[model samples]
Target: MKSIVAGLATEHAENGIGPVVLMLHGWGDSLHSFDALVQKLPGFRIVRLDMPGFGNTELPKDTWTVEQYAKFVAEFCKKTGVQPEYVIGHSFGGRVIIKAVSQRFLEPKKIVFIASAGVADRQNVHNMAFTAGAKIGKALLKPFPKSLYLRLRKELYRVTGGDYISAGALQETFLAVIKEDLSSDAAHIDRPALLVWGEDDIVTPVEEGKKIHRLIKGSELKVLSGAGHFVHQQKADEVAKLIQEFFI
Candidate 1:
């Protein structure tokens, strides 16, 4: 069910009972993405929420960066009266959790990252070349119908491996978030952390997980073979077991 937290309609599930473990999902994903893992984690209080814009929650009041997202989550927690004992995040959500913990917004004892995207992404020359090519194509096709222009733009993004979503405030927010580098923040997180990554993941890459492991003191890194970006979903049981052991 949806709960009104800090004036935003947040869809969440608070199941089981014990220590609180807040779950934050990745970009373009909702709280339901953690269902499989949550089912296996009945020993702890599972607090999973659909972050703003991705699920039933309303979009941010403005074009927000990673810090803004972390602040929103902090506000939500305060309004909901939750002080999490543990925190888990994936991809974009991981970025938020890192910012929150490093800035002392939330003091969870333990943390977990699944194919996280906190490290600033490396620049791709191929994408840059494609972007240049697309700009030229756009200039040439300026007189075309609006629908035709959009279709051509989508095709360009698909062919060039460019990350383009429909133009809006959320897309702008995504652009702002990706440009942020959280290496310094990772270095400041002194809590025990579990970094889990899919060896086959190309989105965040396993290398990023290694970087996070090296930055966070006493953090553990686990690579799951044959898993992709959604490692937690692909191997829900194993991921749950790992988290249970780590927190317990």
Candidate 2:
């Protein structure tokens, strides 16, 4: 464990030797998310950290945008005294990495995005209607008492029936991060990239990975059958092998 910032210590694991490899896990996940992959990558020095708000790391004092997370990652690299030769990020971690490379905080020779989540998917008809109705409901309830307004909001969530993340600060942070898409960053990244996605993933989806591949020059997309959002965890050995070959 090390203090990447004052009052915040990151829980991390470092092992092996050779070129430096930095691994960032998904939202609601921690450094241990890459345990199996870490064991398989014996030739490189692997550093996997529990990103802020997950695992042993403390949550951010307030909501943070993706760019803030990217800068925090840069600070982490500086504090650890290791510039990554290869960087691997899964889901929300991928958003941070995308921004990092685009902003030139830490230039890695290669990057691996596993079931990344940064693209803003097109809203389906149902979602579009739901959003419209929710807006109308909010305006209609403006004259109601505060308690009544809150009740109607909860009912609106029930009617919309979407899976919202955790409440309060974490949820607010999630909202802040997801609002920004990384298509521009993907287009700007000059480094070789490997995109791994689960064929069956609903969260982030295979389409999003394809979109990222299309934007990144010389990027390769590998779709694993029967895998989900946590594809790296589900197919750790295969993912690790791909990472090794991509870096080579």
Q: Which residue pairs collide in model 1, if any?
A: none
Candidate 2: the clashing residue pairs are none
lDDT tens per residue, model 1, 161-200:
4444543448667666766788899899999999999999
Q: Give stretches of model 1 more than 4 Å off.
A: 120-145, 160-163, 166-169
Predicted structure with the largest TM-score when compared to the true one: 1
Worst 10 residues of 1 by lDDT: 120-129
Candidate 2 Cα errors over 4 Å, as ranges: 123-163
lDDT per model vs. reference: 0.84, 0.83
Assess the local accuracy of residue 143 in candidate 2 as a C-alpha lDDT between 0 and 100: 93
| Model 2: per-residue Cα lDDT over 158-231, one tens digit each | 77634432333476676566567678887899989999999999878898898899889899999999789998
**TM-score of each candidate?**
0.89, 0.87
